[model samples]
Target: MTDLNKLSLAEARDALRDGDVTSVELTEACLKAIDAADVLNAFVHKTPEIALERAKAADERIKAGDAPAMCGLPIGIKDLFCTKGVPSQAASKILDGFKPEYESTVSQQLADAGAVMLGKLNMDEFAMGSSNETSVYGNVVNPWRRGNDDAQLTPGGSSGGSASAVAADLCLAATGTDTGGSIRQPAAFTGITGIKPTYGRCSRWGIVAFASSLDQAGPMTKNVRDAAIMLEAMCGHDPKDSTSAELAVPNFEAMLTGDIKGKKIGIPKEYRMDGMPAEIEKLWADGAEMLRDAGAEIVDISLPHTKYALPAYYVIAPAEASSNLARYDGVRYGRRAQLAQGDGITEMYEKTRAEGFGHEVQRRVMVGTYVLSAGFYDAYYNRARKVRTLIKKDFEDVFAAGVDAILTPATPSAAFGLGEMTEADPVQMYLNDVFTVTVNLAGLPGISVPAGLDGQGLPLGLQLIGRPWEEGDLLNTAYALENAAGFVAKPGKWW
Candidate 1:
């Protein structure tokens, strides 16, 4: 039999239904893979007992003819999702030893559909960094390498672990949250399919907060079809989350007809960053041509405010982050610093926070606090908000002009070595999100599909942004691009 861990989520689903495999067997295969891939640091928490229990229940459901699409499937839950009795740290020391008594809405939904939980995947500490370097568990190494250099490369972030786990076949699929390109960027870097649904599409009830307005949850999988199948199970209305959409969830997999004839795919002129690798430019053009051959009209369009998106996103996301993260003081759940005899509340607060947050997270929180300060509020935060509105308007204008979706390169380039980009300029790291932040700011759906490999044999991906509240259509479009690209390259396992 083929490696059970290598089967796509959809393939595993069918296999279970046909009695070719059992959830227990599939779960054991995944656990074995996880044990072997521990060097990657993809999973920060391991829960084999819980996984086996869930698998047994799933097998029972299947035997009773009560199975759903996700029944008998093993999946990795992002640490951001609060699973009852499971450590739900957001890969941060601030959340050390914190486990929610209740399950997150999204994970709860997947569990209700009979999905087996493998464990918690690592992520950016407080979901702040572009690379997984900010994670307290250590950086997650991308399985892909450049010409066998053996230099460690980041799997992008803050969904780095989810992307890494799926690409390495550690799990069939994993849940990921995107706040200013967390999901798509990592997916691109890891050579997998990841979709960030519209801002309100997935409830953020129990996932750790990043930038409130920009955070969204979606599925990361090996193929577009698997993404569609898992995504359908991940989304729905939840009264617990105020941002949850009231609309009915559609059967996204059934919408993949592969016929995108006459669909208008917009090509943003500004994504061609100066000095970008010629390979990236060529891949973008090649992706466009592939879609064009698939009968979609390719038209060049300008998102005039594209240049301001990063600046605005940096300001706005941090501002919200500062406010949202204020709740993590030592008074509540999670870790607390040891108090000295003379320590006051202020001292405890300072000591706990300083000890808890990592460097990158501290930097963002300070920047956020500064922007929201009285002296700089208008100069920084307010202006950035205005720019955000303009950026959203830019996409709205393009969509209003009859574009069904916009296509662009998912990342500026292939995966970079873990320490390649220096800390002398954090902007270098921030620039990684330049292509993907606009989608989050506009509250639109975006997907990254592995498209090709670079000259060094590392994978590259193409991104598609769709209008709000149209994920089924967006996913169908991704299906077309996925079929056109026929990208089946997997990162050779060296970890």
Candidate 2:
């Protein structure tokens, strides 16, 4: 029999329904795989009992012929989502031992759809860093490595564990939040499929906040169809979250006809950055050609404000983060530092924060506080907001001109070794999000599909940004790319 854990989410769902497989058998296989793959550090918090219980229930639902698309599928829940009675630290030391009584809206919806939870995946501390190295649980390693080297590589950031788990077959799929490319970037690095729905598409309630305006929860799956199915289950109008979209959800998987005929795909000129790795440029062009061959009309477009997106995002995300994270003081439910002699409330706050937040989180908090401070708010924070508006306008103008979607490279390069870019200059590290942050700024739906591999044989992905609220169309284009590329490379088992 095929390795039960190796089946994609969609395949597993069908097999469960057809009696070729049972949810319990699949869930147990995943549980056992997670146990053996601990060296990857993908599953930060394992919940075997809950997983098996949920699987048993899902099996009963399937037997009764009352199962949703996600029913009986085992998946990893990112630590960012609050699962009732489960640890959800968001990979931050301050939130250690922080378990919420309520489950996140997205997770609750998935549970209602009959998906089994295997465990919580790790992420960057407060979803700050571009690489997974900022995680309090330590970096989530990429299953793919350079040609013959065994050196550990990052699974990208914030949603790193989600990408790693899906790519490594630790889970059929996983829940991930994309705040400035968290989901897409990691998915690219891991050679999988991920889509960040328009900001506000997924309810933010019960998930730990990062930059409130930019954080969007989406699926990281082995294929685009699975991403669509899981995303449908994860999104809806939530009265609890003011940002959740009110429109009725569509059948995203059904929209995957793999036909982009007559679609006008725009190729933004600005994204051809100076010193971008040649392979990325070639991969972007190759993707455009594939789309064109699939009957998509490739048109040259300009997004002039894109150059400012990274700078603007660094300012806006951190500024909001500084505000959102203010709730994590010592008086909260999370860890409180040991009190010293004469330590009052003020001392407790300082000590707890200093001991809790990692270096990257602290650095951003300082930068955010500085930008929002009285003396510099206008010079920095306010100016960045203005830039963000222009960036959004760039996409709007292009989409208004009959362009169905915009195509670009997901990341400038494939996965890099852990600690390769972190120690020296931080700016070098921040560049990883250059291709991805613009989508967040525009609140546009974007997807990254593995198109080719880089020189090191690591996977490279092409991104397609769709019009706001038109994710179904965007996903259809991605399906075309996926079919055209025929990218089926998987990381050789080494862990």
Candidate 3:
């Protein structure tokens, strides 16, 4: 049973192929694990019947020699990814009772490649918060703990549940969408590896749009090789999504070499901000040293527009979210509050929205609407977009200067106490994404690998930001760092 929990997707597949284990056995093992770890609330919905049925089918396919790449592997789909006949809430009350008649392009693509869906995992309501605390379903606590400290710590959000589930071995790997650090941050918090591919690398067709322009779907798993395998299955061109890249997907799993010799890795000078936690700073330095020892050239590069990225992303993401969420006005899909005695159609729409959206989401919607309004449009929304261009330009300039990739900390600090953030102001919470958001704004590929642990023993993540559509290179570097860090242990501190 313990070995079942520790099995990688490759191991599980090999077991199935060798007849050492059956798909049903693997699926049942995961179901048992999910039931055992119920306190985590990692899964919002568990369709054991569906999962078993899928596993049985996979078993038959294997017998018939018709298996696909991920033949019998079970994966956790984030609730943000719409699943046909399965509730896809984005962890928001506003989207409650919303079940798409269609599957998200990415989810469908994975299913097409033969991966089994365990269930939908939890997330920050509408993918808004930095910590999972903002979830309407309640916080998903980290499965690790300090020596004597028993307080629950945050598994990073909006993809927190995906990270937690993968880390806890509730599922082999899980799908997570990144809009400003959603995937990588949670992966870091949970002491796992996750990647946010270049924007538009994965189709966002049926994904609940948080910040459409910034959103990119990726995989979260225990190791870089697993991430590479899952990511290969996840990426492709989709006619359903116009923004989906037409580029051919690479065989990422085949390219995971331990070699880094002669690779030009850049250390961005701007990311080394003041007040950075000492442990994180040390981890960055140590990571650079590891690459140097591996015979890779580490050069210092500058991204001058770094300071402006956080403010610009906050403005732009909210602005886009406001426009995207306006469709849920009580008439179409999603929940609708019962009308009061005197309420008309417009009043019904007003009442439904007020009752459905949570506090943080409401605040964001208001900010988004206010910024896009006639008078404030130029001052807030447009100006933020201009800054976004400058941030992208910074990356372009650095890349042109002969830097292959840039390295930085995935988050400003390690995962904070769940309630520690709620007590502070919203800007403080937003600042957590300071280092990760710039890559999203610049439309570049970024990934987080377990770097080291802080003095408190919480895991730290080192981020590698790559040029647009250069996920292969980013994953290669992350593979190197993953070996260097040697921190593949699961969440040891249980809340």
Candidate 2 residue-wise lDDT, 289-400, digit = tens: 9999999999999999999999999999999999998998979589999998988999999999999999999989999999999999999999999999999999999989
lDDT of 1 by residue, 1-495 (tens): 569999998999999999999999999999999999988999989999999999999999999999999998999999999999999999999889998999999999999999999999999898898889988899998989898788999999999999999999999999999998899999999899999999888999998998989999999999899989999999999898888889998999999998899999999999989998999999999999998999999999999999999999999999999999999999979989999999999999999999999999899999999999999999999999899889899998999999999999999989999988877889999999999999998999999999999999999999999999889888889999999888989988787
Tell me the lDDT of model 2 at 469: 90
Model 1: how far is 353 from its true place, Å?
0.5
What ranking of all candidate models by TM-score puts the best one first?
Answer: 2, 1, 3
TM-score for each model = 0.99, 0.99, 0.98
Q: Rank the candidates by lDDT, best first.
A: 2, 1, 3
User: Which regions of candidate 1 deviate over 4 angstroms?
Assistant: none
| TM-score of candidate 3 relative to the true fold | 0.98
Tell me the lDDT of candidate 3: 0.88
Model 1 poorest 10 in a row by lDDT: 417-426
What C-alpha lDDT do the candidate models reach, one value each? 0.93, 0.93, 0.88
Give candidate 2's TM-score.
Answer: 0.99
